[model samples]
Target chain A: MFVTPGYAQETAPAEGELQTEIVHEEGGEAGFPPFDTSTYPSQLLWLAITFGLFYLFLQKVVLPRIGNILEVRRDRIAHDLDQAARNKEEADAAVAAYEQELADARTKAHAIAQAAQDAAKADAEAERKSVEADLEQKLVEAERRIAIVREAAMKDVGTIAEDTAGAIVEALIDRKPDDAAIAAAVSQVR
Target chain B: MAEDPIHQFQISRLIPIEIGGLDFSFTNSSLFMVATVVTTGAFLYLTTSSRGLVPSRTQSVSEMSYEFVANMLRDATGPQGMRFFPLVFSLFMFILVANMFGMVPYFFTVTSHLIVTFALAMVVMLTLVGYGLKTHGARFFKLFVPHGVPGVLVPLVASIEVISFLSRPISLSVRLFANMLAGHITLKVFAGFVTTLSGLGAFGVIGAVLPLLLTIAITGLEFLVSFLQAYVFAVLTCMYLNDAVHPDH
Candidate 1:
C-alpha cells in the first residue's frame, strides 16, 4: 500500500498520460529493461568493481577478524576446560591421599590396640604365676611346722604315759622310777 | 505508475559517463549493486569492530553469517575447498543484500536482470574452470567424464557431460532472474488490482482486501525466496568448486 513520491506523482496524471506512455512504450522507444543489452556494460563494470572491492574487504579484513575472534574464543574455552579438568584431577588426588592417610591411621590404631591388649594379657599372666608360686611356698612352710609340732606332741604323749605308769607304781611301792628306764619303756611302747 | 509492473525494473542513467567510447553510463542497477556492496561490507566491518569474546547481537549476526558460509563451503568442498571461501561468501552476500534491497517498494533489483545474474554465474563458472585447469592442468576435462562408463559410450557420455557442464551458468542465472522477475511481477499485479479496485465504490473496496492480503503474503514469500536464492547460489558454487577440486570423482 506504500507508494513512493515518484510513483505517486507519475500516477497522478494517469488518466491522460497512461495512454501516451503506453504509446511511447509500444513505439519501440524501449523494450524489457532486463533484455536491453545497452545497460550490460555499465552493470557488469559496476558489478565487477563493487563485487571486487567487497571480496577484497571480506577476504582481507572482515573474515580474518571474525575468524580470529572465533579462534580466540575457542582457545579460551579450551583453556578454561583444561584448567577445570586439572583442578578436578588435583582434588581427586587430594581426596585419595586423605583416604590413604585415613586408612594408614586406622591400621596403626589397630596395631597399637592389639599390642596394648597383648601386653596387658602378658602382665596379668606373669602376676598370676608369681602369686601362685608364693602361695605354694607358704603352704610348704606351714606343712613343715605342722609336721614338727606333731612330732613334739607325740614325744610329750609318750612322756606323760610313762609318768602315769610311774605314779601308779609309786603308790603301790612308794618309789620313783629311773628316767632312762621310763624313756626306754616309752620307746619300747612306741 | 504501479499499473505497469515492469516499470520498476527500468534502468535510467543517473550520472552518464562515457569511457573508451562505450555506453558505460552508471544506471540504477549499478547504484543498487554499489549499495549492496556497501551495506554488506559496512555491516560486517562495524559489527565486528569490538571483537568481543562474547559477541553482541549484531556481532553475532555477522559471525553467524561467516560461520554459515564457512560451514557450507567446508561441507561441500572440504578443507581444501576453503580457498574459494571469499568468492562464495561475496556472491552470497551480494545476491542476498541486492534481493533484499529489491524488496523495498521503489528500489531497483539488480539481480532481476539477466545480465547481472548471468555475469555472476559466469564469475563462479570461470573461477571453477580457472582453478580446475591451474591445479589439474589438462586433467580438468575429466570433470565432464564420469568415473565408470562403457568404453563404447565414452564419447557420448563425455559430450553429454560437457553440455551439462556448459549449461550450469545459464541455468543458475535464469533460475534466479526468473524467480525474482516473476515474483515481483506477481506482487505488483496483485497490488495493482488492489489499487484499481479501491478506485471503485464501497463493494470494490471490500473486494480489494483479498488482493491486499495476497500481496502481503507474496511479499513475505519473496523475502524467503531472496534468502533461499542466495543460499542456493552459494551452495551450488561450493559444489561446483568441489568438482573442480576432485574432478575424478
Candidate 2:
C-alpha cells in the first residue's frame, strides 16, 4: 500500500536505524523531533545560507527582470493610447475641414447660380426692347405708303371723268367738241 | 513504521560533517531547503527568460507571484515599505515552496520544524527592530505606547504593549510550525488508519474507505493551509515592517 520508495525505505532498515540513533543521542528520551534542540544549530545554519542565497538571487536577478517587463508593458500601452488619441484628433480635424469646404462650395455654387439667372434676365430684356423698336418703325412706314397710293388713285379718277364727259357732248352735237371746250367744262365741273 | 507520524520529520544526517566538534552534518532538512531554493530560483528564472510582451502561462505565474507579494507589501506598509520587497518576497517564496514540498508524499517538510520556523520569525523581528532603530532611532519605542491613554494607565498599557511586542516572534513562528506539524500528523494518522484497517477482513477494508477519503480531503485542506500560512506570515511581516517605518501608530 505504501506507494513512495521513501516510505518503503523508511519502513525497512532505515526506520530501525533512526530509532537507534535517536535512542543513542537523546538517551532513550525519544522526544518529538521538532523540539529536539540538538538539531537547531545545523538547521539555523542551513536556513541562513539557503535563505541568503535565495534573497541575493531574487534581489539581483529575478526582481529587476520582472520590474523591467512590467515597466516596459506600461510604457508601451501608454504610447499606443497616446498614438490612438492623436490619430483621432487628426481625423476630427480632417472631418471639420471637409465640412467647411463643403459649406464653402455650397455658398459659391449659389452665388454662381444667382449670377447666371441675372445675366439671363438682362439678355431677355435687351432683346425684347430691340424687337419692339423695330416693330414700331415698320408700322409707321406702311401707313405712309398707303397714304401716297390713295392720293395717286384720286387723280386718276378725275381724268377718267373728264374724258367720259367730252365723248357724251360730241355724240349729242353730231360733231366733235373742241379740245379747249372739253378742258373748260371739266374745270367748271371741279 | 508508517504508523508513527513523527517518523516523517526525523532529520537523518546524509553527510556526517563534524567541524569544531559541532554536529553541522547536512541532513534531509538541508537537502529539502536547498531543493526549495533551487526549484524556486529555476522557476522564476526560466519562466521569465522569454519576457514576452504578452506573458506565457508559466511566465504569468511568476509575474502573478511577484505582483501578489508586491501589492501585499505595498498595501500593508505603503510605498516606502517597498524597500524591504526582497526580504518579504524571499520569506514568502521560501515558506510557500517549503510548505508545498512538504505536501508531497515522503518529502521532508522544512517548515514543520520549530527551530526552522523560529529562525525565520527571528529574521523578521531582527529586521523590524534593526530597520526601525536605524531609521527612527529612539522614536521607534513609540510603537509600544498608546496615543490616548489615562496618565495612570500609561505604564500599564505600555507594559502590555511591550509584552505583546516581545511575543510577536514566538506567535509568528509557532503559528506556522504548529499548523504544518499538526496538519502533517493528521494526514499521516488517517493514512495509517487505511493501511491498518485494510489488513483486517473485508469489513475492515470497507471501514478503511472512510479514512482514505478523509485523508484525501485533509490533504487538500493542508494544501490550503500551506499557502495561507505563507501569506499570513508575509503579511504580518509587512505590518511589522510598517511599524518600523511608522511607529507612532
Candidate 3:
C-alpha cells in the first residue's frame, strides 16, 4: 500500500517536538475522521430489534426444518439398510430351502431306481432257478424212457429168434430129408 | 493543523441551516455510514437469497458467519440457544462491518463514538428488560431477590443487584467505544512518529524504520481487534438474550 506523501506530512509534527496539546484543526484532525455520537441511540435500538427478529426467524423457521430433514434422512437410511439385510437373509434362506428340496428329491428318485433294480434282479434270479429245475426233471424222465425202450426192444428180438429156431427145427424133423436142413436146425438150437 | 475540531467532524452541509438549535454538519462520516448500511444490507440479501445446497462464494462467506454465531450461541446457551443464532449472527456482522469500514482512512468509526455505543448498549439492556417482563411478568421483579440469602442481607443485595443491572448499558457501550478510540489514537500517534523521524537526517532514517515496522504490526493487530470486538459485542448480546429468556437460570 502506498502512502500519500502529502497526507503523511500534514499529520507529522516537527522533529524532536513533544507536544501534549492536541491541535483541534478547523477541518478535523489531520489524518483522522471525525466521530459522530448522534446515531448511538438509533444504532443500539436497531441492534436489539434486528437481533430479536433474527432470533424469531431462527426459532420459528430454520431450526425445525433442518432438524426434521436430518431426522427423516437418518430414519430413511436405517430403514433402507434394515430392509436390504432382511431381503438378503430371506433370499439366502429360500436358496437353502430350494437346495435342500432338490437334494431330497434326488435321494427319493435314487431310492426308487435302486428299488426297481433290486426287484428286477430278484425276479430274474427266481425265474432262472425255476427254468433250471424244470429242465433237470425233463432230462431225468428222457433217460428213464430210453432205458425201458431198450429193454423192450431186446425181449422182442429174443422171442423172434426163438420162434424162428422152433420153426426151423420142426421143418427139419418133419421133412426128414435134407441133411443140410437137419444140421442147420441143430446148430441154430445149440 | 485545522483551528476548529468541529470542522474536522463535519460530514457535509445540506441546506446549511440550524434545525432545533442543533448544528448538523452532514460530513463524510455520514455518507460512509449510509454506504455501510446499504452495502451490508445488499451483501446479506444477495448471500442469503439462493440458499442452495452448494453455496456460492458469497453464500459460503455468509454461511461461515452464520456458523460462527451459531457456535457462539451454542456454547453460551447450549443446544437450546440454537434458536437465537440469527440475532447473534446479524449483530456480529453489522458491528463487524461497521468497525472494519471505520478503519479506512476517511471513514468514521461509529463504534468509537460513546453515543453510538451507548445506544447499542441501551438496546441490549432494554431487550433484556422488555423480554424478561414479557415472559415472566410480575415475577421478573424477583430477579433482584435471590433465594436462600439471610433476611438482613436482602435489602443490600437488592440494591447492589439493581445497580449491577443498571451498569449493563454503560459496560457494554464503554467497552466498545474505548477500545476503538484508544486503538485509533495510538495508530495516529505512531504514524506521526514515523513520518517526523523519517524526515530527519541520516540517523533519523534508521529511527523511522523501527516506528514504521511497529506501525505495520499495530495496524495488523488493530485489524484483529476490530473483528474481535464485533464478536465480543454480539456474544455478550446473546448472553444477555439468554438471561432474558431464561431468567431463573
**Each model's RMSD to truth, in Å?**
3.0, 4.0, 9.3
Q: In model 2, state the lDDT of residue B107.
A: 87
Q: Is candidate 1 or 3 superior in DockQ?
A: 1
lDDT of 1 by residue, B73-161 (tens): 99999999999998998899999999999999888888999999999999999999999999999898888878889899999999999
Which stretch of 10 consecutive residues in model 1 chain B shows the poorest summed lDDT?
B1-10
C-alpha lDDT of residue A38 in model 2: 79
Task: Please give, for residues A1-190, the per-residue lDDT of candidate 1 as tens digits.
Answer: 2333236447665565556546656877455778877778888898898899999999999999999999999999999999999999999999999999999999999999999999999999999999999999999999999999999999889879888878877788888877678778878988
TM-score, prediction 1: 0.90
Tell me the TM-score for chain B of model 2: 0.99
Model 2: CA > 4 A from native = A1-11, A14-30, A143-190
- Candidate 1 vs candidate 2: the DockQ winner is 1
Off by over 4 Å in 1: A1-21, A27-29, A168-174, A178-190
Q: lDDT tens digits, residues B1-249, model 2?
A: 557777778777777787787778788888899999999999999999999999999999999999999999999999999999999999999999999999988889999999999999999999999999999999999898879888999899999999999999999999999999999999999999999999998999999999999999999999999999999999999999999989998
> What ordering of candidates by DockQ runs from best to worst?
1, 2, 3
Q: State the DockQ of every prediction.
A: 0.46, 0.41, 0.09
C-alpha positional error of residue B106 in candidate 1 after TM-score superposition, expressed in Å: 2.6
